[model samples]
Target: MAHDILISGIRRWARLPVAGRIAIVYLLARLITTGLLLLAAHASTPQSRFGLSPSMGQLVLGWDAQWYWWVAENGYPSQLPLTESGEVAENSWAFMPVYAFLAKGAGLGEWGAGALLVSLVAGFFGCLVLHRLLRDRIGSSAAMWAVTFFACGPLAALFQVGYAEALFVLLLLIALDLVLRRRYAPLYLVLPVMGFTRPGILAFALFLGLHGILRWMRRRAEPLPARHIVHIVALGAFATVIGFAWQAIAAVVTGNPSAYLSTELAWRRNWLTDPSAQFVPFEGFVRGAEFWMGQAGLPSWSGWLLLIVLVAGAAALLLRSPHVRRLGPEIRLWSASYLLYLLAVFFPQSSTLRLLLPLTPLWGALAVPRSRLYRWGMLGLCLLAQWIWILCMYGLAQTFWQVP
Candidate 1:
């Protein structure tokens, strides 16, 4: 009788409205993550960044969150700070203003509280939108499973932190959904917010260009209207403008033409043997590959070979994998575009896992497998990975490599 009652309860839960189901899942995931965080906090030592027995607030507001708070407390500096060597130092210009200012506007009495509230709300909504985005392509069951994987994945810490990723991802999922539906006008509004929310809008802009070309090639079959062509072209141009607008704004304020680029390069300097290397598109990854390989006691040539294999393997998977192909063209295109963007600009480091958050939509492809064992095993792995990530990044943040 007890077994039957439990089964009936689960059946009722499964019958709830999609939003209700998502809310329940999201809440549970947050609870689990919170528990893991608490565990990490208890285990934290004076050696850790958070110190011994730190609170949830401290853990959330540590690392880059401190920068966001600095931005909120004091706006970007009119004059850039410099090192003893006269190179630009990392400053508020490295972070975008949207998340910081929005947290301030939340008026939650404390910056950490406000930032946490924003991340929590945005993360829940992001899951809902993710479900909606994936459900149409894959069935509701698979979509829900994908959301579960996303909520409980390795970077689940993002949902509870003061970072802009949750909000940026919420906006990105909405934008991607709008694009897949061919609703172009809404994107004009979405693009600006997304651009300000994070650094990934350039990837989205590139995806738009590729999407336009793909539509044009299939125009005979799908009948591309002239108005859509115009919308696509205009929206792509608008996104490109927004992508660079921040740099221009930084330049005007600081009275230095390369203010933003120099500020970004400041962070890259930490890992480079030649601190004065210029920003070259696609060179970061190549250098990062060699750097990390050397740190791991491997040959430099092996790093180059590994990078080639990884890039080629990723291309092959996107082009030929049955599971990924089931996700349809828009998702596959976005994934490819984002990966390319990362290779072009980002220097891989401990934060690379966090940077890959934009590819969350591909979780749907992993959910395409229907075996109960496969699904449950993957969930177990995700939870384990999440705990490991929290412990390394928060509990024992003793080295630069442990950064989240």
Candidate 2:
């Protein structure tokens, strides 16, 4: 009887629309994963990292979640806290304000755990919006595969966590969809919110700029309308200025004009001996690779070589994919610019894979294979990778520097 009911539910789920199926599958997977994690948390020693939350649901609120919760519960410190030597300590200024702001107003009894609920709900809708965006380009079948691949990604656990990736991705896709549809009016509303949420808005803005240039070139024979002129100028300004709003707020609140930048640099400074040193791009990844490789008795440069190979492989696969080729200029530019932003500004750090969540459209490219065997094989591998990531990076990550 129980087996029949479960099979019946699976049939019903399969009969639903692509978006509905995506949502149901994603939420149900999250439910089972969360329950199992909670059970494991309860079974462990209370003092361990994995045991940080026996409540299971709160397990998603791990490291960065604490920083966001700080902003939500206490707000930014009027006076930035400093170390004994006058250096800036890690604080809420490093985190953007959108998730914190929403979590604060959620009215959940505990503001910190409320963030997890916010993330889960946002993730569900984000998946649906992602499916919708892909469906317009690929047909419904390919789009469904894209969403499935996204939901079961190795880093997909981050979506269930209290991170702002879900919210940021949802806003970005909505804004991108509006642009694709030539709906500029609603973008004004989302662009500002996106700017407030994450620095990825700059990439989105660049994508929009590229889209505009291509459109103008195609329509060069036609005279530019007053409305197009307004939209082009307005959107460009919105993207450029809004990305820096949080930095301005941080500067003003902390009373140090460079508070935001300094705080960001300070994270790098933590591992460096020189307090006055500047952050060098790829330095962290190189250094991290050296340390881990040395432990395995490998040459220090092997780490650097490995990173180069991995990046090159990913790029080759991305560019060669038929699904990626089907993407419009806007998405292609957005993906490229966003990856550059990650490389140049964000730096190759521990959370780099998790940061790639905003490039949700890449999953569509990965899903382009028409073979059922290939799709199912990739899905199975992704699920296995998720389990491994959870165990090594989250569950038994007590003594390691596991950044999710």
lDDT by residue (18-54, candidate 2, tens digit) is 7667867797668655654655465545545766545
Name the regions of candidate 1 deviating beyond 4 angstroms: none
Q: Pairs clashing in candidate 1?
A: none
- Name the lDDT value of residue 304 in candidate 1: 95
lDDT of 1 by residue, 261-338 (tens): 899989987788585446789888898899999999998999999999999999998999999998999999999999
lDDT of 2: 0.74
Report every candidate's CA lDDT: 0.93, 0.74
TM-score of 2: 0.86
Q: Model 1, residue 220: what's the lDDT? A: 91
Query: What are the clash counts of all predictions, listed in order?
Result: 0, 0
